[model samples]
Target chain A: MDLRDKYGLLIDDMADMRATVRIQLADGGLEKCDQARNVKEAVQKLSLRRYDLIVCDYNLGQGADGQQLLELLRRRQILPLTTAFLIITGETSYEQVATAAEYAPDDYLLKPFTADALRTRLTRILEKKEALAPLYRHLGPKGDPVQALAVCDELLAQGSRYSLDILRHKGELLQTLNRSQEALALYEGVLQQRATPWATVGKARVLAAGGDDTAAKEQLAGALKAYPNYLAAYDSLAAILEKTDTEAAQAVMEQSLAVAPTTQRQRRVGALALENEDYVRAEEAFKRAVEKDRTGFFKSHDDYAGLARSYSAQGKVQEALATVKDMSQYFAASPALTARQAAVESQVYAKAGNAEAAKAALQKALQTRQGGDLDPATQLEIAQACFTSGSAEQAKDIIRNLAEDHHENDQVLAEAQKVFARAGLGDEGGVFLDATRKRMVKLNNDAVALAKAGELDQAIAMLTEAADRLRNNCQVAINAALALLMNIHRKGMDTSALARAHHYILQARHANPEHPRLEEVASFYRKVAPPGTLILDDE
Target chain B: MDTLLATVIHDAKNGLATLGAWLEQARAQTPSPALEEACRQAQRINTQLVELLALHRGSEGTLRLAIADHDLADFVDDLKAEWLAPPQSTITVSWPADAGRIGAWAFDAYQVKLVLLDVLRNALRHARTTVALRLAVEPGGGIRFTVQDDGPGFPVAHSATMHDQGSGLGLSFARLIAREHRTPNGKHGDIEMKNAPQGGALFSLILP
Candidate 1:
């Protein structure tokens, strides 16, 4: 309960408020506290050294707030799970501070609190954090969820006072590990005792993951009615509805936006509205997302691209072109920005019947292809532009390559399908994407079969070629590494093969760190390679 | 109009909270009865402003509760910390022992804590020697919080019409919050006030 040893950070824009809270923090026995006047300084301080606690004022005087700061830190993994974050807010902003569903602070205090109250809250949160340290040690960005689940079991068996908190983590880990039935049972057990919002939304998530979309939708609908401020339910419902009904999904996103108009949620609504051909709504959503944050930390290239495309769909060619131009000014110079802007410009010009200019922009976008992989969205934009410029063959080539590289990723494949749909080839796009996915699957299966039949060399050759071509495909890279390791296991270590295996393992980790099979493959390399071989970064 | 009213009330509430904190600091440094009374009054006004703003939002149909799971023991400890005993009174407050055993429940902790604090303060005014708060699982479903004080029970007329009580705003706000807590099965929370069989006033807030 002692705060004397804990390092703390206090963030507030007002110097007076910062001084007041500093005195309070010292009075509360926390002497080693740093001060940050703004979000930029806070991020810098966090990157330099770790803190045991952070007390941030909700109103940071710019477009940024504590909630956004928390989201930024969490998304970038700049803040570890061990650090306790507490938000201080006035009554006017407490609802917003309280209902921050994802990346919520460890605790929040209403402003005007005495030092005694502050110390009490700090002690309570730190005690809970200390009790759950073992579970959290395996929970965040680099932690193993499998090990975290085991820790949850141990704590639960010991009758930990924070059993409810532990159970919440356990259910999420279960879902992440793809154990739907167990997660569903866990949620149901909690619900039998009380109708908690997390358990209600969690049960719906399990239903959705289990592919019972109807039941999931019904559960989410009921949950929203009871807990209308629950953002997670809206997000889950929209994700499920997006596959079958874009219009309904857009509605859900709009409702969530009404509750909390976060730039991320606004971008999601814009994208969904664009898909549903609600061009005006899309334009509004995207405009809000782009203009809401003057700091430019939360705005993404996707928002400007979405805004421009929506303008183009509504035949506002000048406005669309202006938005595309403005996007480059907001973001730093990068190949992704170059590709996204040019591709969006091509779409706008093509819509306005300027074929020559459209083709020129499309060529410029394609030139960025040699600079290495553009993001999936930018690539999709380029393909859509290609389809608009009377190059169906070129467009299909782009989609095919993307599909093969990310065959396991349904989200990317769905985006590819949307590109085809926008090109007036919905059914044909579905069939084409399906065939490409099947081909990628067959390639992996054939290589694995060869390896099993004692043809390690052939398997290695096939998988290595595919993995080399599809650098972003973690599955192929993992299989390639496994094949190399298996060969070394059978024929003893060849340094060349060992080096290639190490390369593919690192490539797979870079592509997708949380791939379920990543640990197994990495451990295999560790076992087969001789001592003092290449060390895995994760280890 | 609603936005303007709510904003003004919110600002006033925040100002009063700051005043209360300052008064508390002065009381701690100087140790005066007058500063103690000023702190109590400042907190009262702050609580009233919070209630008024919430009522304004309720009338505008914009009131939404941020219901989440909160550990009962932590919540009770928070309430105990925030509760300011009446000036020059020897009355003691008792908290529930089974809060940890009850584990956690879903409710808007901020508003609920305010409601319980108001109820406890009211009980302190009426209690002869002791006031106690207890937690239990409500019959049928949900969680219940009871505030009991060993004082003269509410008169028969006032028991039915709580408006006869001091200001009447606290009870109205408490009722509004309790009813706002609901379940997927269509059950809603409620507030009940009555004379306890043990010759004391008992108030309970049940949340689903």
Candidate 2:
């Protein structure tokens, strides 16, 4: 009696689940299974336990529909390999939506289907999934990527029924291993089978990584031309061009946003347009992103800040101020984000012609940056605000430091050029950029020469001195780490030198995680020094 | 006449599907031969209703399909399982081995399933012993789905007689489905009904 009272609702839910999966066999026989009634309950059940199959209805009454739920499950990697997720749709529109999704359901069942129909389809899907289960099992919760590569190779060689799937998996695994060459060959093989957009995108990425930008660009352009709505081609193409051709990147981004305007894509397009200095487009994009991405986990204060910048640039000072006020409401007060917000606020004030208020806000922004080590991007942001407020000396100092530190970094140099161009010091800024870059290169070269000449300690000493002198310059810091590693190789693990090596590599990594040389140098630390050091093991 | 026919068929389909759903649900809770009979009969009615509606629309040139892609073997299995009860041990599915890699082809998977269901139902009902559903890639470039049965061939005036009651109209609907399957190479699909050389009724949807 108490069980009924406690679990009456649960029993009802179980019954609903049973009905969802109660597919008909021939002669009106029912095969028993379970499914949740709605997306919330489905996600809940899925997270708690993995079912062998899920048959979801397209119209789930309200909230997220089946396709959206399926997308979420795939994106979050919540669905198990053994599970077959099928979406049942009563309308043709759901079919189009399912097809358009990057991660679609295993199969879609049209409505008014008999139970036998569903059972047959489900059986076929489950059998296929079973055949590929070994590959799936290897890539599961406790899986290792290195070991998974071996599994991929074994399955690939054996040539199972899932040979094609295994090949795709191997290609992806190879890419993850940073072995782009092998991945490129596999992707090319797949493209020969079918000009699948995903395979093309993979080929483009491998090409881009290998420094064949022109070929990568041609491949990406062909895919986009064939399937204009394929978001991966647009995104990968935009990402490559974002470094060198901001305007083209922004244009491709806008085209992609038209196909499927996800909030994440919207924020990306906004940032890119802002980078390209297309204020009108940036304002609309950021506003759209902010409106839709309020609850999005990927949403950041940068979205609101970008919107405010666009608004202020367009001379809509009130809207810019309001955008900042809204940003504060969305995010908690952190020193870094707070500082960025104050800088945006000063820009709004300057646009409104409030000299005194702008100066005060600029001072507040500077105070926020004084105690903390602001990132180069943040430094640039604050510097832009300082320049707008006519604090020429402070603005020039910030840009000079940023320019000297990251003169060779494409992303930083591009942004730095914009800053210099905006301040009407365009040609002078180019000359300054050259001089600073030359000086750093000379120092780096001198240190490396000392290391090569077998004066390892002197090289290490010189680099460390230069690292201290030129703060936040990752190129110098990375060189300094290399010198220290060479010193270790020569002197045999001097604790002090090992410690210094750790300090600089960590600093370099923290400065720019995307640096190509980062993992290369850090791997050497593990080779020379013994295990149990935090630096070697931490990596 | 067309308006009345469409309205009645549409309503009947809705009723039959609703009936089929409830009966299937009831059978799951407490299954019986009687409930299964009711469900099967309701399915037949639903199939007839869908056929009538589609045939009428085809005649008026109002029929449109949500053409998408589906795996051929899976599609055949679904038809076999749904339309054949005891699923007939005599009934088997065959396709050229390499045609298995045909993987997925563009078609109106659901509606085409309906057309094949009707054709297969007739074959199963009439077959003496065996019903074979064979899939083969046509010599030129298209795919063919054929339902053959060792059954007494149709009467000489079959279409003339069956057309009166909209039974032959089902064939017309099947033909319409084939024609709607337009390929990028600008070829339209076709359907043929003929007596097999080895003594059987032959029905095929030749799709580009």
Candidate 3:
């Protein structure tokens, strides 16, 4: 069907720009079109009718920007695959836009365009869409990436000007499929034919995904040598250096920010600086992020917290306190943020030897935790602050609870260990950890011994008791249950046992992903589980 | 009318030439794709041509920013529709994610469309499949558009004496129009060209 016959919506803040675009579309034979001045008007129009295409400005006074509008539309499943959404932008730096691409849009129109040009681009996009309609349809409601790749392969074979796009899509699909080698090879093949930053970045992504930071950095370096302004290259290079070299990573982030200083990138740089303990740089970067986000959608309480963190670390206690108050004014809606500010305030008060004020701040923090789950990381920090203020018992209880709740989390465990060490309770913490581990292992070992002795009922009872006692030891619980179930429910694969195992494994995975033993347990459950069913064996 | 049209055209062309010259200088002093020159060439041509064309229409009292129900993707597609790159030269443009057919944007839609097309044409003529376009709308209030090619970007040496050689008028035109549409917040739209790290020229446009 022709696009002119399809209804569409056009949204722009400027009347002139809107009129200009409207005429251009008429010239291109698009007959049914409506216009809105901003996102609010656009939303009204959107609710009233379905449009085949949407032309929107990035900035619309109040409500949501074009990206957020699109995200909201997608979130609500309001826009369909057949519907086209285009964003109008006037940004010089791609960094901000790069983050937007993570959400995905159909097309972008830079300002100062002509009618003829718009016609040509729109026609091209329409034809390409028609070509990939089958794939689009099959990918279903929100878009299944794997199926999209398979469909792209068919379109690629059809041969067109968009083969590069198809190839890139295929590479992305392959990457998603965990076929990193194939994805890398595909990206490399594209690079061999022509040096494109996208292809180079694609290769770097593969390398990074493959756990080869050095190769990814090398590829990024080569690309940068050829095309220094390719922003993706800088981002990829920075990501690669992030883990191994904090100084280098900060330098890369700084360089990237110098080229295109977006609020998000600035925040990232600040957060990284804080991580690297570069308090001065962190303070500067966080301030810039706060300044930038103050007037844009990038506004986030995280930036405020980051600024507070930087100031606090630098011993600018009053400045930090003031920053939190400013944050409170804008972030009154976020209880967690209030809690964070309180935690920071308590630190400041404690440092100043104002015990009463510190206590009050801590109490405020506890109040914030009353109705909801505090983020574990934040809770850990508050607990640490409490311990430093001679509330060692409270700290001990907090760590103990956290350790038990996330028994499989090595990272959290290590962090908890450090916290304990700092609180002068390292030996006690270590002993607690050792005892917990021994208890879990002994539970499993005892069940195994009972099962081997031909006392199936006793073995099952022992496992049941063990599972009850070590409720948070997901891995052990799954194994012990499986062993008993293997002896008792050998009729035709124990569905109950499999279900329970899967639940424990899933929770364990959430707590400590990519564990070496996870896949083995999964396979075991798969071998003896019912088809198309899941069990929540988590305690 | 002719004088005004010519003046606008001249300004755009000169802007492109100057940009090309600067790029050449940058290329000679630096290494590789000489991106600044290439970007100048792309922006000048795209922006200037639109300005001149608009002016030409204005003189005749027909100057208007067209808005209608057009397939935005089709417009971008038409700019560089030919996919089969010549044996020795190639131009590859893909919509790795949906071939960019799910959305459309309105502005001086036609001018921006041509800016993308003109860029592709230049890449095809000067380089080959080295051309790629990435179009998206940011959560902020603007659109992000990118065009790139895998061929070695603008020749650095020739760029220095831009008016002396194949001085790029296309990029200049694009940039001029973009600048005109620039917002008072110093956020006017901009067109930038550079070399792709893998090996090509890239032109990026940010419009608000």
For each candidate, report its DockQ versus the true two-chain complex. Answer: 0.69, 0.13, 0.04
**Of 1 and 3, the candidate ranking higher by DockQ:** 1
Docking class of 1: medium
Model 2 lDDT tens row, A312-371:
888888899999888767877778777888888988898789988988888888998887
Candidate 1 per-residue lDDT, tens place, A1-539, comes to 99999999999999999999999999999999999999999999999999999999999986678888899999888998889999999767786567655567888898768999899998889999999999989887567788898999999999999999999999999998899999999999999999998899899999998999999999988888888888999999999999989999999988998888788998999999899899999999999999985455777888999999999999999999999999767888999999999988998999999999999999999999768988788899899999999899999999888899899888999999999998999999999999999999999999999999999999999999999999899999999999999998998879999999999999998887777778789889988878888777674
True contacts kept of 3: 0.00
Q: TM-scores across all candidates?
A: 0.96, 0.67, 0.58
lDDT by residue (tens digit), candidate 1, B70-173 = 99988998888887777678999999988988898999999999999989988887889999999999768898999999999787776744522567888889
lDDT of each: 0.89, 0.71, 0.65
Restricted to chain B, the TM-score per model reads 0.91, 0.79, 0.55
In order, the candidates keep a fraction of the true contacts of 0.63, 0.02, 0.00
Stretches off by above 4 angstroms in model 1 are A100-102, B11-35, B162-164
Ranking by lDDT: 1, 2, 3
Clashes of each: 0, 2, 104
Query: Which residue pairs show backbone clashes in model 2?
Result: A24-A115, A24-A116
The TM-score measured for candidate 2 stands at 0.67
lDDT tens digits by residue: candidate 3, A500-535: 556566654554443344545555665666567764
